[model samples]
Target: MGGGGTAYLTGYEAAFINPANLAVPDKSTRFSIGIGTAAGFFAPVMSVGSASRQFQAYKNYLDAHQPEATAITASEKQLILDRNYPKGRSRSEHQHRMDLILGGIQWRQGDRAFSLTARTRFSTRTEVGRGWYDETFEDLDSSTSVRDMSLFQQSQFLHEFSFGYGQTFDFVSGLIPRVGKLYIGIAPKFILGGSYLDLQYDARYWFTDEMDQPLFTRSFSYRSTGNFSGATRHYTANGDPSAAVQRHFPSSFQQDFSDYTTPTGMGGGLDFGLVYVLTLGDDLSLAHSGNTQPIEKSLRLGFSVTDLGFVSYNENPRSLDHARDTTLTPFAAASGQKYEGSPGQYLSFFDEVPDLNPFQFNQVGRSDDSPERPFKAVLPTSFNAGMLLQVNRLKLAADLTLGLNDSAFNNTKLIAHFGMEFAPVKPVPIRLGAQVATDSPTLWSLGTGIVMKHWELSAGAQFLSPRGSPALNLSGAAVGGLTFHF
Candidate 1:
């Protein structure tokens, strides 16, 4: 619920959050199996300067008017540019994430627990400067001189198999009457790298009035490295395939399933967690058989460090670099041609223009068919800590997550989540949650779950908006899962 599972989750659902919780499953559950999926997007409009206000205006305009228009008017185009583009140098970022739990099983006996899970994760991020947006929509007569304008994108997909174990320690339970038990857990994961892509583009442009046609000089460099066959391809300057370059491109997803199943890389990772539960009244003896008597707890505290490893991609990996400086007439457009197709198709246009000929696409790594020097991509590591409080039929929880590094899946920022759950009836529970981050708008979520003796089902949705402002659900997410326990 709103990414607040660090402390209170149990059974199979705790495999990814805090494995220590697995050892504290329901009193009657000895085994559990589950499947789940989640997807989300975050495109924060920063509240610095007028950019955020303009973005809201632009969104409102689109929502109110634009459902039936075939062609955009000049006034509309100008209005869009004025509203969306920043006044000076600025940047915007967008991120997307998806997770799939193919299957998972958890088994607990006495004070020990074990789990195995198979899952896949995908994430991507894109960042662009204001100059890039202005260049795309501004009129030809608009004189804009921009330096060091840049666009960057990174994406990765991976399948993981994890084995986890947790053990409870009650040696100190009797010393502190208020402390119920302590649990520690560790999970080692085998990761299969499905695909990876990193693209960086930078440009400098200036307009010169020295010539009658207003000479425009532009210099740019483009670099990309990965096995993203669906998005990019390479060819020799003669418009033919080079035998020296290994063409690992797959034609289509419908025709080839191996494109996704094949491993472009391989790596390993580990997760560590610790949890302590505090007793409310009387402390239960650890001598009980099968731990039949449940440990009564008023508060629970959890901590974990996850995804600490790297993947080295060596199988047919490709790296391309291109840089050029050219001078041409202002606002020159190729007749009867529109920008379309993949990156390879768009780059082909440079070869057709006389002023931009001699375009050279250089491969950076080894040229032979043998394995190339590997490129290492690190995992999105993070540290999480949270606390949960239980009171009769009501529960409250709060968590804090700190990203250790910046990547497509994680950012180096602190995020806080707060959640509450109330069980009006024994078999049904209602939940409400909220999230706040350093650089993004606030997120609110509502969810419900049905808990029976042998089966469980849950679903939730998230909405994004600024606090104290008109609610504009610019982004949303939906997640659902099913689990069976015995």
Candidate 2:
């Protein structure tokens, strides 16, 4: 469901999502290849007003007046409470993010496959829990309530390059109604990536511009692993961090974009998958997992793991080396990051290091020595299992995806999806799916593919809906280019 393609992908597309499918093509040309890009944003905050109305209002006002001079009236704010601010109490769970993936490509032939891809992702989340809402939005007071509230946020931008190769093999497995060969594939990948910037902040007090309204952090910490040539210093909320900024880093720190990466390096990754195909009736046909291609297939099962590795940045990137308390504190990954947790546990940016040290005032300040030596940042890993039931032109698939760790450049938590693709017109097909995760599940998703005489084309979103009640809260998309089937 949603973007979970581990089990159902075929041909050229299999190179990335699950290369195991490369060896077993559906009823199509033996060889295939394609490329495309997809980007999206997802957040828990929902809008209370119609997006169309707001867009039209802004268009009309801009046409008649100037945006720099006009302020929304009380009525306008009432019309769209969601756009004006947010709904419900601002909790630490409130998050906002944007991700981009370019040059997503794959090539497949026989039981062999290759994939090349480049990706860029960025995200920021600020959980404004309970009592902090009044302090954050309007009634600026931290003492009005007894609730211990904190507003904290973290953000990151990183890029990746991956080239992979995979091979599929089948073995006799008597698990089915009759003796069958089980298909399994593994892809070893080479990857190169680095972080441009990383940031974290927390609120100690609240106020508006009318007051001193200083934008000072109550308890915050920061570290930069980019190409910043200036002196690297770790800062905590206790001291005047800005003062240390002038003393440590150079003003040119922001001027040079070349030094944005702290620990840039190359690493390796792996993708592994297994598929068991079953023949239904009629002429016995061994079909690809969840595909109708095999002669006659009733059921298919698939299991796969993606992005299972880390990039070791050989250079010692700058890390915040501030002194802190001894209490075991946990830092969370950005909203969409992965981590080791049962149902509720997760690793975040804070988990970037195994140390549970929290930044403290008297303990930490700018330092020349760094604790972070040449280290490896784990890539986001996804473990997924799916099943497909197929008959004729219809195929249904269900997938369960679990994030291995939240420390990767991009991350996600436990999610489930249900999707189906049926060729209403023979080889031409349409797909619909849903994300059934507990946090922000999207109600709908869609995709379509056209099989021409020589090739096939496909595109669609994981799921999307305007911000509002009952709106689809899904994120991500996978649009394809051309898969010239040979």
Q: Pick the candidate with the highest lDDT.
A: 1
The prediction achieving the highest TM-score against the true structure is 1
Regions more than 4 Å wrong, model 1: 36-89, 135-148, 170-175, 202-231, 235-261, 281-297, 320-372, 466-469, 472-476
Instruction: State, as a TM-score between 0 and 1, how close model 2 is to the true structure.
Output: 0.65
Question: After TM-score superposition, what is the CA distance of residue 154 in candidate 1 from its true location, in Å?
Answer: 1.4
Worst 10 residues of 2 by lDDT: 338-347
Tens digits of per-residue lDDT for model 2, 222-330 = 4445432122333333233333333433333124333333336667777788877565665354434333243335576788888788766655354544432223223
lDDT of each: 0.61, 0.49
**RMSD versus native structure for model 1:** 8.2
lDDT of 1 by residue, 313-431 (tens): 77656555444444443352321222111223223334344342222423222233432346787888899999998765678999999989867787788999999988899678898
Number of clashes recorded per candidate: 0, 24
Q: What shift in Å separates residue 217 of candidate 2 from its native position after superposition?
A: 14
**In model 2, what lDDT does residue 87 have?**
46
